[model samples]
Target: MSILAIKHGIWKVAGEEVRQVKQVTLDSEFELEEIIQSNPAILQDNWLIIGRQVMTVYNTYIDLLAIDNNGSIIIIELKKHKTNREVVAQGLDYASWVKTLSPSQISTIYDDYVSRYYENQNTLEEEYYEKFRIQLEEESINNSHQIVIVASEMDSSTERIVEYLSDSLIPINVIFFTVFEENSTKFISRAWMIDPQETLENATNSVRDKEPWNGEYYVSFGDENNRSWIDALKYGFISGGGGEWYSRTLNQLSVGDRVWVNIPKVGYVGVGTVADTAKKADEVFFNDIDGEKKSIYKLSKNAKYHEEYLEDGINAEYIVKVNWLKAMTENNAASEIGFFGNQNTVCKPRASKWVHTVNRLKEIWQIK
Candidate 1:
């Protein structure tokens, strides 16, 4: 319904306007390590790692033992000052040992921890946090022990160990974060995500085929039944919550707002809020970006994404602004760029003519 109502994909209505967004947060030379250290997203309770000195022999006692928010224990082997390649091998050894813990054994470890681990030991004990951890782990892993590694870096020898262990076809993940100083700024940051599969997919898709607008861009919305299709789109495009989750929140939402929903099957959906009804229609107009004189051209009733009449040149009056507008930066990867602006919708190019019209045609996406 909305696809046909506002501007088409790439084009929008001219006289319609938006308030000029104040460039309030001027970009500054800040330390990335500090920024990473302060990132709220990474410090989630569900994925926090906890443990102490888990041993895998071979002159390697794990530096720390901790469960990720996911309830799997991470065998952390830290290297101070400079590290050797064998540290990675040690991590793999710990990973193997962690994979052998039984349900009862894992719970026992957590039981011994709750009262001794934190500042408010009573709080966790009272809440039966150990029981909760056990329950969560039970629900998460099926039969095998969940294992992972946490280190600042991987040496070639350890990298080789990881390769060997991984080649055995086990469901294990490796996480490495580095603490470094750049431009007089110290940063404690994860080198990147544990998975490289998605990054490779993104690179293949985003080459030369960039978004038309300099704003934000999103991927296609997904349905429960059509998971793989949705996943592929997300991997292939800069998509977030651009579908049902966004549409459902319209009653409580406005233009220029953003939301993130991590679908278990599809990863993350970054939806920018737009119009919800006839009341919002008046508010969803485009203010002139340039202060030049403007003219309005009424378009014919061809219900396409951008406009079917690019054959007629820039003849259309205005374009529709949807969940588009990606940042113009070096690499253009979402994880590799600076973020600013309303999570609200963007009018960006979709098809060839830059139609911002997203082809999200799920019935759940329709507003009442």
Candidate 2:
């Protein structure tokens, strides 16, 4: 809670010799809002700012409106240092209005926000996929929402109300941002009242009413600048690369695990059983069209998997061999409303939508 520093390798904590940083007050709540608007990542990553001073049907305006990768609307309200319980009540008021918004209305709100702020930006759907690396399903948009009350600090009453609401399965929270001045330089740090990931999980589960995971994994086959989905279909494998975060999830697959692969912005293209655990790109060999065994690096010139980081342990591509039960080209990929999606390369989706997606895919692919 306190930012302290040592000068000349000598610690000072007593009397006039103590070195302390001055915590300063922000010029205005608008100044805090400007900092957040310019960089939404300061609040959270994978969020797209949809509106500023967003108006409600009740003739009130929300401080900032955003949408996360999961398509849940994020209502960010701002206040100066030490906010009161009224802000909590106000946040609930705004959420009540946000909960009833239809998909078209959400799109229109984004359009207005763009027209007023960003002159050179894509439409809602285009920007959503670009930011999240997954297509936006209209039916899933705004199915749930979160309220974030940000201030320099929260008073006891406000914190208590937020905790109660969050504990009751309401996706609401408070964030504290403190500004400090040290030797003519200003720095800002942030903290949350509750663990964000815990809040998100509780919110998602409560709103989605997801069923138990059925032991199947969801794979996002991001066949873009680095890898090729065509090569994957031909080679009997799935992959991820460019960074550890991208490739590490493939390690979750083991021999005999079932996986359903979805190509980002495309559709569900394959369902298969894992034939092997993950291996590095150059280490994975497949029999080519010539019936000659060759490394993936050699067989698929177009993919050039992790060419930039072939030998780099952290960034190199990783592959998991699969035996397809049924697979299709991108042109024949199956897509429909309400299918489960995630940015992770592999996840055990427990949402009801995932169950529906698998059942429908079984019928479409005639896979029994």
Candidate 3:
């Protein structure tokens, strides 16, 4: 509390002498965006992408052109003093222009940029061309996309850009970073990249703000008592496996026939008919499953389908509608086939149980 005590406290805190190694400079404190700006390898050393500044396009040359490891162009807009919300529009503009370029045009752009820098950058063109050839063969290069925003602080430039992008329904990210000051110590620095949207969403609003969940919640009013989801489930299952041999082929059922196969380990496999005939390929798709691709298949006999499913009192009440809400509660039922799985390892709730469960939810919600 005294002056002498305060001075002693200050001295104690600064007791150590500044070391010579403290003067060494390093870029370790830069965020991902800034890192890429200096050394593109912050991503990886893939030639499919190269960092460059465009001479003829938007007055702004990009901080990084993070192309796909193959050829899909990933336009990166980096901000050192700003945030992504600042440059999304400009980045989008560049993306639009880049998308319009043909393979030849793209090569020319690369060549043009190259010619200015490399004496014989024509060689880079061939290498890129060969890489593109491989990418096409591998079924890559769907489209060039992806927005990146990086900065230690989101300034007015960043906020303006983010608001505009959000209003335009442009899916872009605002990567916030905490830039640290250099300390008189050995080579060590720290920085961070955080999602700005998440931070904003978590912040309290002064007036009427929207729900934090956004649209991720159920679109259709979730009526815990509604039996409609049950009906939807029953209709989902197309029954009638033709025979036993069908289960072996994973399609022992003929087209147009709905068959359920019982896997002792994984439960029943169901497939609905999309075609008709012995050779007709099974649509083999699932009705409703999440986190997987579920498909139904044609079968020979409904017995084979039921053989595995029917046990004890399960089929006693016809199970016209099951308490799917209950089943889901008992089990992790966030998937399309939250109730069950079809072939292709996809989830397809059993027709009877699925429908019944849906209705049960309606029942609980008392909607229908």
Candidate 4:
């Protein structure tokens, strides 16, 4: 993508009158590596770089190592003057090593990296909770991994190969970064070879050689303060808000989809069929005490919801209607050992734990 500057009511190159901004060549791939090391968000907003130039069993160094909120490792291998095929192969090789890593081994790797890179640091578990606000599951770490090939550009053959690997559920992708220079300033733009969301979906499917998805979704209902679980249970709707990220996943719920809602630290509280797609807080209505349809935001008992609704100018509360198969208050919620949980507002989980959880909940809730 080209970067253009609008100046004096005319679109032109950032630095020049009529010429477009020119792409600049990095002196070395290490320069690019350092940039990403400083801020991995340029590649993925949710990723935390755990190791830089991490060494493998074969004695070769990986360009970078990162972990996402889902506890999946990311193998980032820079092209770095290597041929496209070579970089792809290297990334795969590193992934092979990464998949073999146990939770303890991963912690050791992080300890080594921090000792070498930072003056002081918390344990990976602490840092992970601080960064993602969710406890890291050691057993779940590295259940799946992704290979990332970073390059300035990819040839047609490289692109085709990447596409084929992605199509086959290999969880591999290429990121192309272009550097532009103008007026002694440098700018970087990144583009993914395949849509990252599609890649993630493929990775989720490929995880643990799992069985097919059971067409059910997991919803984490953590906003009990703003949107009361009692209110939701009475009103026949699930709501999320506070930010776009918190509410965006609600879009995945459509009419007739099966959803199992968990109350984060509480437990599984409800299983229901989605009755309607998501709507804004002001647009969603439910029967009030007098049996009159009233906007959920105007309900006095849900004062926190109304407060957040009025204050969240950009990302207002969104609610999805649900027809309850079975619902319960938090006091009556059900949970046991090994129940699947995630930080995402909504997720189509492919883990074996998810299947087991759903089956167990069915038995507990007496759902046929």
lDDT per residue (tens digit) for residues 41-126 in model 4: 89987789899888889999998899987788998889987998999888888888898999999998899888988987889998
Best by TM-score: 4
Residue 183 of model 3 has an lDDT of 50
Clashing pairs in 4: none
lDDT per model vs. reference: 0.34, 0.81, 0.36, 0.81
**lDDT per residue (tens digit) for residues 135-185 in model 3:** 232222313344555444455665655555544334344544332223543
Model 1 C-alpha lDDT per residue in residues 93-189, reported as the tens digit of each score = 6766766676566655555555455554443223334533222435433122333444444555655555554444333334555444434544444
Clashes of each: 51, 0, 50, 0
User: Candidate 3: where is the Cα deviation over 4 Å?
Assistant: 1-38, 43-48, 56-60, 80-86, 113-142, 155-169, 176-368
RMSD for each of the candidates: 19.3, 6.7, 19.4, 4.9
The candidate 1 region of ten consecutive residues with least summed lDDT is: 1-10
TM-score of each: 0.36, 0.67, 0.35, 0.82
Worst 10-residue lDDT window, candidate 3: 1-10
Model 2 deviation from the true structure expressed as Cα RMSD, one decimal place: 6.7
- Give the local distance difference test score of model 2: 0.81
